[model samples]
Target: MRRVAVIGTGVIGASWAAHFLAHGLDVVASDPAPGAEARLRADVAAIWPTLAPIDGASPDRLTFTADAAEAVADADFVQENGPEREEVKDALFAVLDTAARPEVVLASSSSGLLPSVIARGCPEHPERVVIGHPFNPPHLIPLVEVVPGEKTAEKTVETAMAFYAGVGKRPIRLRQELPGHVANRLQAALWQEAYSLVERGVATVADIDTAITHGPGLRWAVLGPFLTQHLSGGPGGIAHVLEHLGPPTEAWWRDLGQVTLTRELVETLVAGVDEELAGIDRAELVAHRDAVLTALLAAKARTELP
Candidate 1:
């Protein structure tokens, strides 16, 4: 098994550590904060029972360190989740380049910043650096966007896809580098519509939640939106649905709002959320999210995969 180093210890980073370890890979995690090491170790331990039951798995090894170089010294792969600021990412990758093997692949859990930006200050920059952006709680969510920057090596992309697949992640090769990548971009599109609807008083916060949670989201759990639509229109496939629904879809696209996150809009959104989640505590919400995500992943594993 390869040794993997997770270069940040926040929730996303800790989740990566948990997944790598559960897959039987030795994971060495590093973060600069004084107590980050212990916190990471504890987070991984807490998530284990939930993870173990997913694939009947156990890690072959584990290690913790505060020094980035020490954490990545002999690692086969480095998964970074440091501060999203370009300068911080550049500095960290530069250090990682010096410590990791020349051929070792480096991946980022960044949701938006392009790989080119993160690779700028590193000696090994383009050849081995690529975005391995995963959905939140990567241990449970399987979609990993394997995005390649302009200078990223062809072989690097292939190796990353293969590597992620080995760990049981569903890796998608995005054709080009785009801010927010694919899934997030799609999500943001829906969010824009949802917000606009709320702002226009067409729906309440809870109504928007129900529309997705009970409607398209249910079928989407089994198949993606396009495929679901295709199935809905019968054997004529995607073409049939498009022929019928294309006009309205195009109209919606044309009318979509480019609303900025203005102060007033932000306040409205925040207030709505506060009202919606009035009685729920943050910790309880997180627990609820984890439980739902676990069940969703398990159901996906059984129903979506062959």
Candidate 2:
């Protein structure tokens, strides 16, 4: 798309604006919050450096507006990043659906909310609304879950997928809707065990973070869990791993921890994170993470693994 409208210029919205601008698209953004324009501009400026070297991007084409309608009135595509509240999103989508051109595809960056519910207010043209959920820091991350509601048109889904792919994103089409979608569900499962370990005093927060980042997280960056397990099977691959360890793996799954975030557990988690992050600036940590992620993606791109 040559011109894109970004509704809700929050962190996610701004990141998307940066990404689209990096792809050489003119971006018009709108958010009602006080000083939103300044924050959006700052965020895009901060992220532009990282995006620039990859695709020769610049921020000269970015513009901000206080009116959401004006932002989407003549845009080719609309990326809505409104608050996660259902009532808020439903109302926002109605406004967007009414303002945008009938053929313009409007996508939500909702993390877990259903597209069906988000589009329910726009029965007149629900077909054009779909969920295009992106992981945190959308400009740096590549995964975008493209979920179509029951009423969403097949053509709309295709257009959303193509749009994200054209903007240098990895778009996964989800056939069914589930709360938390795919990645967040996987994350919840892992975090359940992580919290249980901390609750049981088996490991500290720092230890757990280190274990993942220094160990499996490193491999996970290149290959997912299934492939990692397949590689672990030596000559036989995944079938062998399953044949030999399937029963034990099943047993382990049965024994995996389930945790409720009670007050005490919450306090423990808070204390642990506070201690872990003591004396460190969060911005510095984020910068370090993005730097390493950039290098990792570059390295993975240069290598071919089965």
Candidate 3:
């Protein structure tokens, strides 16, 4: 079994470690936080039952350390999930550069930082470092975007995709990097409208959420947006959508609310969310989200994809 090193033990980081471990891959996790060791142990144990179903129902395999270098010493792959700060990532990369095996592939769990920025820290492994970003709660959401930097080798991209696939993630190789990468760019597009609705007092946060979770979000759970659009067009396909609903959608796009981060707006948004979430405890919400996501993934696994 391949040994994977996880360099951070926070939410997204810990999820990666749990998925790796639960799939029966040997894992060595490291985090500088005071109680990160205990946190990771508890996290992996808790996430295993949900995560194990990805690879087949089985027991987990995980080990952790506070020593970053020790964790990557002999690892076949190193997944860096350190703080988003460049300096912190640079420092972590420096340690990983020394500890990891010569040919071991290294990937960042960064949401937006360019791989080129991360490459600055590990000169020797410049060809090996690439962005292996995942959707939130990665073990449940399987999309892994493999983004290669300007200096990144073609072989590096190939290797990274293979690695993610071997681990059962649905990896997509990005041709180039743009702001927010692919998935987040699509999400930002949607959020622009969500924000607009709230700003116009047309909908509350909860109402906007209800609109998606009950509407497109449910369908998206089974099919991608493009495919859904194609189906929505009926026999005429995309042409039919353009002939009918396209004009209205374009008008809505033109009228989208502007982006601003004023304090009042922030407060309003927060208060609205607080009111909307009054009955649901934060911990309980997380549990519900994970459960629903698990069930959705299991259901999707049974579909016949085209």
lDDT of 1 by residue, 192-275 (tens): 988887777788777888899899988887889888988988888889889998999899789877667778777778888888
- lDDT string for model 3 (108-185, tens) is 989988888888888777888899999889888899999998888888899889989988899998898865789998
Q: After superposition, how far is residue 24 of candidate 1 from its true place, in Å?
A: 1.0
For model 2, the run of ten residues with the poorest summed lDDT: 49-58
lDDT of each: 0.86, 0.90, 0.85
Best by TM-score: 2
What is the lDDT for 241 in model 2? 96
Error of 1 at 184 (Å): 0.8
| Superposition error at 238 for model 1 (Å) | 1.8
lDDT rank order: 2, 1, 3
lDDT-wise, the better of 1 and 3 is 1
Candidate 2 lDDT over residue span 182-202, tens digit each: 899999999999999999999
Cα RMSD to native, each candidate? 2.0, 1.4, 1.9
Runs of candidate 2 with Cα error greater than 4 angstroms are 53-57, 304-306
Q: Candidate 1: where is the Cα deviation over 4 Å?
A: 53-60
Clashing residue pairs for model 1:
none
Pairs that collide in candidate 3 are: none
